[model samples]
Target: MKDKKPRVAIQGIRASFHEEAAFIHFGEDIQTIECSSFKQTFEALQNKEADYVVMAIENSIAGSILPNYSLMMSYNFPVVGEVYLPIQLHLLALPGVKFEDVKYVTSHPIAIRQCIDFFDEYPHLKVVESSDTAACAKRIREEELTDTVAIANTLAAKLYGLDIMERRIESNKKNFTRFLILTHHENVEKKDIDKASLCFQVSNQVGALAKVLQIFAEQNINMSKIQSMPVLGKRNEYNFYVDVEWDNTKQYDTAIRQVLKYTHNFNILGEYQRHEDEFVQNEREQKFRAQEKITRKYINVKKIVK
Candidate 1:
């Protein structure tokens, strides 16, 4: 007998980047519950409508997703793992529609911003901001808008049956997004822990934050990320969110003890294994390369019969 697949909730439709990250983490065995927004994604998890939630935390080009950090502080969900997914934006439109046919381009504002350089060459095309990248693609297909194109991932294009007019159209080729796998606090396990997401606040004094960081340095714990979010309704006060990595559990435990002495409202959000980038890339790229290899074999056929 086999175990039942987990139901993962994501913000957007089937072909969004969140869904892509979920598949990367859980493989193709899990079921996805699409939520309209990040808040809805958390609500689905809180209501037990999903076994886990895939949330994008940050992007290399856009920096931190501050809203998501705020959501994590409010929900206090356990961060079980993370996945860094490379983003590839494409220009997609209805079949047989050429570049001359496009009058407007629609996508999420962030997606539009990433391709600003490309759009500069074609000043005639109007860029319209939309809710979600995949949603924009969906709109074009459902409304039969032949004059508008979408800027989205290849997955969205394939899902909406849109032809990709251009590939890798993003201004920066190094764009990647980091997504967090979240679960209820009680369900979180400390086994195989190497990376942790923590939140705390230091007393409003000079050198206070530096002392907390020094403790991590002394204990041999590496600080991978540190972001500060303002404490709501508090003037000039903030809550710091930090991600740390450690090779030894004992070192992390000792560091926490020292860190606690200098911080306020300290919270161990979650401690989980640091997902390797190579593993995710190998699994994802292999499938893509295999398909491409098959296509190339037919297109460039010169068999050797020795």
Candidate 2:
């Protein structure tokens, strides 16, 4: 019998960066399902209509996507992997339309913000928000709005067959977005791995957070990312989401246990290897070498006993 291809759910229509992240993480063999909103994407996975969900977690320019962070805590899905993509915003319109003909522009809020400087120059242009950048492009194409432009990615422009009136319109050239690949199953094995993400809440006492962090410092564990979000159940209480490189040795287990001693709210979201093509693997390799040194020291003591 032939096995079914995995279906990955992502927020937004075709040509969305979320879909690109899904393709990067799962490859081309898998099927992709698009949802209009993040909630719908989560629901698709929760209902077992999709095998996995790819969601954007943060942007280099705008920082964390707060709503998605809250969604992460509320949802039952676990983040199994991550992907980072460089973002290049473009201004697109119908082929015959010139930049001067643009009277209004539409895009996702984040996209509009990224290109604020460009839009600001055109004081006559009205900026409107849409559900997504790709959706804005689709709307322009469907409505045949020659006077309206959309701020979107190059992929979106290509998908909708719109001409790029302006390219790389984002204020910053180093824009990037981080995405998480989530799954309902927890026991999924990770191969060729390096990074791991966990969620934990520390005691309210002073230095409690410091003590938890010191475990990683003492064990030489390298933390790549960390962000805090308020815990919904308790007033003013907060929890943190952290990403660390996975060392082949058992130091991760030790460090996690040490953090648990000071904080009761600890959850292992996922432990997977970094994407090979990115520089993340190089950073992980350095941490893995540090773990190797610790392993060698333990091995040398056993040799002395013999």
Candidate 3:
């Protein structure tokens, strides 16, 4: 019998970054199920409507997607793979539309924020926020809004039959969104795995957090990223999410055993093959030493913050 194409669920319509990441990881031969929200994507997996989900976990400029982290914890899906999609925002408009004809611009709020510097030059143009970037472009095409342009990607421009008025419109050209490929079933590929993600809580005592990190350091494990989030209803307590990498499988095993000694409410999120080499990872990092930047503050956070 011929095999059924893998049904992959994404958080936005086709041509959105989520769909791009899905195709990047699973190949274009698979079927994509569009979801209106992140929760819907997870529900699709839970309901067996999709074999896997491609969800963005973090951005280089915006940082980690906290809600998706909560979703990760809530669903307990196995992250079997990861793909990094470069966020290249663009000004998409209908054919023959000019910047002077634009009365308003719209996109996902996050996408708008990334292009703040671009809009700062043209205060006359009103900014409208929407749920999805690709949807904004789709709406402009479907409705033929000649006076409005959408801040989306080239894929959206192509799919919507719109023209790109401005390319690479993001504030930081080095921005990238790290997406995790999750599945309902566990993948036991220990020999091929080199990286893992986990969330754990350490005691308030001195060196509580240090002890767990020390174990990883001693075991020669490379910690790629670490972020903290307050434990809901637990005053002064926080949960730490970490991504660690190792060259030797034995080293990672030893580190996990050692980590369990000094942590509580610990959960191994996923173990999968590392996506890129050290050089590619280094290239993704932004260097701020020579450049001036504004301070970013987090006013409020949910139980899961990354």
Candidate 4:
């Protein structure tokens, strides 16, 4: 008999970017449990419906996902790993439908915002917001709507048999989303760990927060991210969530031990391996991406009329 594939939970349907991240982190052979929202994905994990969860924590274009940060505080799930997915947005339409036939373009709010520059050039094309990017593509296929186009990934285009009306439509070509892999099972050993996510609160004193930061600095720990969230009922109190990376495990251990004395409600959310993205490797990867020169049908037309 064959071993069972790991069940992963994501915040969107198949062919969605969430699923793409899961496939990138885990193998393509895993089962995906589609979820409607970020909270539902965490609930699925708590209910034992999934072996792990892949959630978008931040994006280069959209910044932090605050609600998901609250969920992390509520559930306190262990983030065993992280995945970075390049957010490549494209316009997709039916096979026979041309650029002139598209009146309305729909996609997720964040995805639509990323393509604002593209849409600004065509003021006549009505931009509509939807729940999910892939869902918009799926709807057009299932409903056989020829007048609608979807801003989605290449996977959705291939899956729904839609033509790529426009390629690389996003405002920023280098934009990518960082996803955290939360799971109940952690197989990582102590010595192998070099990254950690921690949450704590400090006093209102002038140097209260600085004192803790100084500890990590002296120990040579790299603080990658630091975000603050207000306490629900408290006025001035806030929870500070920090992600730290270190080359030497002993330095991190010494830093964390010293940090405990300077903070309140200090919680180690999880300790896992850090995922670093390679910005440029070769000449082709470092080149500026030009969309106007691309072979899209709209490039030929001077202006798009509604």
Candidate 5:
């Protein structure tokens, strides 16, 4: 007997980019279950209906997705992996509809904001929010509204059989969304190329946050990103979420121990190997080379002056 494919849960419709990321992470052979909302997606995993869930936690244009962070604390799911997808917003509408005919636009709220410059040109056009980008495209196809358009991705337009009125409609060309691949199991093996995400709350004291960060500085751990979110049920309290890249050669153990010594509440969200994609790898390499060049130039100028 053949084994069944792993079932992954995604928070959106069939043509949603979350679905695309899921396929990219888990491969096409994996089965996918679509949920209408992030809550539903978490529930699907909790109920054992799906083996894993994929959800977007942040976007380059919009910053952190606070609701997902709250959900992460509420749920017991572990983030097993992460993937970044470039977001390209497209203006999609029914066939034969011209751009000038668009009187109303529909899309996820973030998508609407991402294309604010384009929408601002037509002050008379009404903007409506949908649950998701692909969901808006589906509505445009289902209702066959000639005057209404959906601002979504090109993939969504193709999947819903809608015509693209405009391509690359986003306000920024470098927009990207970062998603977390979550699972019920927390026992995944940590790899050598692992990045660790942690969340903690520092006591409300002077230099508390600084002292916590100083531990990483002493250990030479490079922090990739850090953000603070308000703590629920506690007035005037905030928790910090941090992502750090550490050397896996036992040196990280000292850093980890030092971090735990300073912070009160600490949770290791996940330590997983970063995704291997040409675009991301190339970007990292380019950044390192640029920094190296700057350092070498500084040293050369200092020597010349001396």
Candidate 6:
């Protein structure tokens, strides 16, 4: 019997950005489990309904998705990998639909925000926030809504047979979203591991946070990202989420050991090789497979379960 494809849970319908990121990381050989919300994506993992989950943690233009941070802390799942997908929002509608026919535009709230500049031009069009960008496109196709348009990715426009009324409608063309790939099992330590995500809380005192930064500098670790969220059920206390990249694993180990002394509720979320390295490895693998004449299949069309 042939081996079953791995099931990947993503917080949107197929052809969504999360699905795009999953395919970019895991290849199209895997099966996608569509989820309506981010919470449901994590729950699918916990329920063992999926082998992996792709979740958007942050977008360059809108900043962090704060609720995901809390979910990560609650679930304590290991982030095995990350993928950065450049967002290109397009105004999609039925083939015969024109700009004047678009009475309502729908998409995920964040996506709607990204296309604010385009919407500002046509103030007459009402904006509606939906649960997913691709879902909006799927709805338009399923319902054959000629008066409604969707701001979604090019993949969605293609999948749902919608025509792009306006291309690259996002306010910022460089917009990109960072998605963290999560798994239930502990990630195997790799020699090429260079990046780590961690969360911790420090006592509320002057210079307490600076002390941790000083330790990182002394150990020569590069602090790539830092975000703070209010600790639940605590007053004025914040939990820090940080991403650090290191040149030497031993240096990172030493810095984290010293950091633990000053930090409470410390957690190393994940230690994994950076996405750049993963891309390079995948390139090598693809080349090798090409030389060996191995065939790979891809799934371009998928059904909307809704």
- Highest-scoring model, TM-score: 5
Residue runs of model 1 more than 4 Å from their true location after superposition: 279-306
Off by over 4 Å in 3: 186-191, 277-306
Worst 10 residues of 4 by lDDT: 280-289
**Which candidate number has the best lDDT?**
1
Query: In model 6, which regions exceed 4 Å deviation?
Result: 1-3, 186-191, 277-306
Q: Candidate 3, residues 1-306: lDDT per residue as tens digits?
A: 028888999998988999888888878888889999999999999999988999998988888899888899999998888887888999999999988999999998889889989999999999999989999999999999999999998889999999999999899987888999899764334448888998999999999998999999999998889989998899989989999988888988998998898899999888998777343567535432222232232323332384
Per-residue CA lDDT of model 2 for 216-304, tens digit only, reads: 98877888889988887798689898888756447877887788898877888777766555454554588879989999999999999
The residue pairs found clashing in candidate 5 are none
lDDT for model 3 comes to: 0.87
- Cand. 6 TM to true fold: 0.87
| Cα misplacement distance, residue 253 of candidate 6 (Å) | 1.1
Task: Write the number of the candidate with greater TM-score, choosing between 3 and 5.
Answer: 5
Error of 5 at 301 (Å): 5.5
User: Model 5, residue 122: what's the lDDT?
Assistant: 82
Candidate 4: give the clashing pairs. Answer: none
lDDT of 5: 0.84
C-alpha root-mean-square deviation, each candidate: 11.3, 6.2, 9.0, 11.5, 2.2, 13.0
Residue 23 miss distance in model 5 (angstroms): 1.8
lDDT of 5 by residue, 1-306 (tens): 027888889988887889888878887787779898999999998998988889998899988898888788788577788998888888889999997787889989988888989877788999998888899899889988898998887778888899988899899987888888888864365556468788998888899889978888887787888989988789878989898877653666788888787787798887776675766787789999999999999999999999
Query: What TM-score does model 2 achieve against the real structure?
Result: 0.87
lDDT of 4 by residue, 153-244 (tens): 99999999999988999999888998998987443344467789899999988999999999999998979889999989999999999999
Model 2: ten consecutive residues of lowest lDDT: 275-284
TM-score of each: 0.88, 0.87, 0.89, 0.89, 0.92, 0.87
Q: After superposition, how far is residue 218 of candidate 2 from its true place, in Å?
A: 0.8
